[model samples]
Target: MAPKDVMTNCHAKSILNAMNALRKSSTLCDVTLRVEQKDFAAHRIVLAACSDYFCAMFTSELSEKDKPYVDIQGLTASTMEILLDFVYTETVHVTVENVQELLPAACLLQLKGVKQACCEFLESQLDPSNCLGIRDFAETHNCVDLMQAAEVFSQKHFPEVVQHEEFILLNREEVEKLIKCDEIQVDSEEPVFEAVINWVKHSKKEREDSLPELLQYVRMPLLTPRYITDVIDTE
Candidate 1:
């Protein structure tokens, strides 16, 4: 049998034994194992191996009404099966959730095709709304290329998203932390401050007449002492 098949068989046997132990034991254990199985064969292998334990675990402790709580169904089974295959054979078909997990695995396995697929999938799936999560995931995985792509995409398309007063102000608190962090480089441009100033100026220009209060705020002597000094010296 192929190495993947061997691994799958081994994992299935392990799962079965764990289930049998649960069935034979009188006491309920606090442990819960979550599996994502993708293929029917993989599900069958798991079910056949651990049916006794699963049956007991489901039937004894939980009521019929609560069966859904333990019952394996839908995408969960398929995902688990795929994961099993990947763990064993170092290859498996792709899916969205699996793609997220597979990228790191591909990198570990040095599987060029799988790694490229993961990158492509991420690039295609990413949007202004999902960019933050993608950025975080890429960063966590140390996928430098993917992280750069995500950052560039966000900076271009989602600039306004992060430019909100709330985000800018909140993130500013960590400017020092970010600067000190060896991993990330802080830009000297101060995009947040510049964005805010530009927004205020644009709003003022759009108004039928710039609000007197706003004008007064911007024109306040203390607001631009350097500019005021420059003008006075020039005069």
Candidate 2:
């Protein structure tokens, strides 16, 4: 074999295998991660090498450096378990169901790889029914790209999305923001007017006061004289 081809086999594969072996041996682990009431045994060197959060905790003269058990708050035991698995194996399987829960944990841990994976999974699951909610969630988590994608989806499918239960459940501020957007998909403003009417009717007593503000978004001149007279005559 040529010199370059002789060592074509990956050396990193062997290192990963060794790390996996160490991960399985609880007896060799020097540190324990305590999440909620559960504890996970882990090696300090592997964790420090893989995670910047752990690296800083271990390298600095911080309390975590001397402690055998480090208590991790705000993350559930199951989420931490999957994150640690990724740290050891360099692989993660993100699904739509778990992505919502895992993304926040990954963010807190400063695991960029897992966070990005979760964002991509969420982007794949976006649809007319859930786009607005996903946009809000992504913005809250500081996922800029995912938030923008969800917003565009919401704008393009506003007509269909407005009929979903999720749209009815939106808070007053959120509903107002969406109606104010010029990009909302409504043909000739009739659907926009009808959607606002339906929205107010959904919670008549409380939403009645919002009719004037919501109606301003609809182009009154585009509606036929008889259609407007028939709908607004009794109001």
lDDT of each: 0.47, 0.84
Question: What TM-score does each of the candidates earn?
Answer: 0.36, 0.87
Summarize candidate 2's per-residue lDDT along 144-171 as a digit string, tens digits.
9999999889888888988888888887
Worst 10 residues of 1 by lDDT: 37-46
Model 1 alpha-carbon miss at residue 174, Å: 6.5
Report the number of clashing residue pairs per model: 10, 0
User: Using lDDT as the measure, which candidate wins?
Assistant: 2
Give per-residue lDDT, candidate 1, residue 188. 34
Model 1: lDDT to the true structure:
0.47
RMSD of 2: 3.2
